[model samples]
Target: MEELIYFHDHALVILTLITIIVFYGLISIITNTFTNRFLLESHHIETIWTVIPAIILIFLALPSLRLLYIMDELNDPHLTIKAIGHQWYWSYEYTDYQDLEFDSYMVPTQDLNPGQPRLLEVDNRLVAPTHSPVRVLTTSADVLHSWAIPALGLKMDAVPGRLNQLSFLTPRSGVFYGQCSEICGANHSFMPIVLESVPLNVFEDWASSLME
Candidate 1:
């Protein structure tokens, strides 16, 4: 995730520089009355323009490819969870445990607690330990749905009869929210994903409670 963010910022800087240079050239052309009667395209300027863009693209592509490789590399996850997307909710199963599973539904506005954010809160949150590699296997029950968490840099399509996987780790304990990115049905907007990160001991206790 850190690499992804850094690449994004680097691309943005390159884009900003290009935009500024283009605008500056435009303004110079508009404001200045410098026009030669025998003006012709210079090979020097053509080569520079072409080479500079190629160099910029190389800079962008290298990082992008590296990020893709990193994302694709499957690590030895400490825990694995399978997320099954439903019509308007999500069901999760901790594959490591025998019977630790539950359905996660969006909390209606009327049922929200004092500090909970509306439309983003869920009845049950997917919990995991911080500083651990957790893999999520995503698939749909009826239709297409996207299991996504922007904060964790995860977005995988939940296709029927197919399982997609993504891995992530939270550096600190906190709550992260996400929503279905695909347009499935009428209640697609209501289905939300909430992930609660806790310490390893807390996560173990929570899992034990569910098992008991």
Candidate 2:
């Protein structure tokens, strides 16, 4: 999400510039048409419209292609977590560690802690280290599901018997939340994804404790 947010901000800047240019162009065209009429040849007008749009498209396409490339650049991950979507819950297994796994169930609103988000809090949160590449392999236990974290700009469908991989890094230590994006069945709303990003040493300690 750290890099994704930067990309989004860049896109917004481009869009804002485009909007301003179009607005000014429209105002100028309207003014010229009502005041001084200089009729250009049809071919000349066609060429102007076509070439300008082509240039703009190229400009837009360049950034879009760069962003896509950035999105696809999967690095050698430091940690890998396997996520299995069930009927009404998400179970996560830390593949890098031995026998470290947990089922994450959404914390009911009535049971939420002081700072916990209602419906977004989970009993078990997937923990990872900050500023490191993390890979998530997703699959389904029963039906179709989608593991999505909006902040990270990550969404991968969990298909039964098939695995979908997602990779990203947290810029800093914090808590990020998400939910099952796919409409699996009746209790779909109860499936929430909670991620706790901690410092590298803190993560190792937690993982070590789990092994004990």
Candidate 3:
């Protein structure tokens, strides 16, 4: 996701610079004079230049629209999880598994394990099935917060009195981490999101046991 964002930004920067330089070069060549004398163009000439930019925008809008549509597409999901943001912690509910729910609190520094990442580790990591589409519903109990997972390209705001939905399909079985993006309160930085994607059978077993 980081690489994708970087490449997208790089493309925009390069294209913007090239477009500006090309437009300036064309104006300079057509005017044939560096002085301000050539700047006083006729109404028709000014209209032509304006229309040229409009034409360029039409071409640029196609790709921009496609990217927007692709980013908003949500596939058929196999499981659903609702994440509710509290004052300083997160509560997750498996909506399809008898509504089994748990609170995921930030692990203290002294409790950190060798493999655990400081500040991003939680006591109860969210569990999902690998290679399956998981739809996430988000809401806030108090102030606003944001749920984000970089590896799966998932981010949504947990607004009070409203529900927002986002979905992702994990291609591999592993743990992915993220943090609350919005600053809700003093412990906002401590609200980390941890996802554990396991095999389908394993996930089913865990979910069944959780309901019991």
Candidate number of the best TM-score: 1
* C-alpha lDDT of all candidate models, in order: 0.93, 0.87, 0.86
TM-score ranking of the models: 1, 2, 3
C-alpha lDDT of candidate 2 relative to the true structure:
0.87
Better of 2 and 3 by lDDT: 2
Taking all chains together, each candidate's TM-score versus the true structure is 0.92, 0.89, 0.79
Q: Residue 40 in model 2: shift from native, Å?
A: 2.6
Estimate, for each residue in 100-154, the C-alpha lDDT of model 3 and write its tens digit: 9999999999999898899999999999998888889999999999999877677
Model 3 earns a TM-score of 0.79
Q: Let me know the TM-score candidate 1 reaches against the reference structure.
A: 0.92
Q: Give the local distance difference test score of model 3.
A: 0.86
Clashing residue pairs for model 3: none
Ranking by lDDT: 1, 2, 3
Residue 14, candidate 2: alpha-carbon lDDT:
75
Q: What tens-digit string does per-residue lDDT give for candidate 2 at 1-212?
A: 56667767877887798799889978988887535234454577778888987886787678778878877667788999999999999999988888999899998898888988888999888999999999899999999999998877888999999988888889889888899999999999889998899999999999899889
Quote model 2's TM-score: 0.89
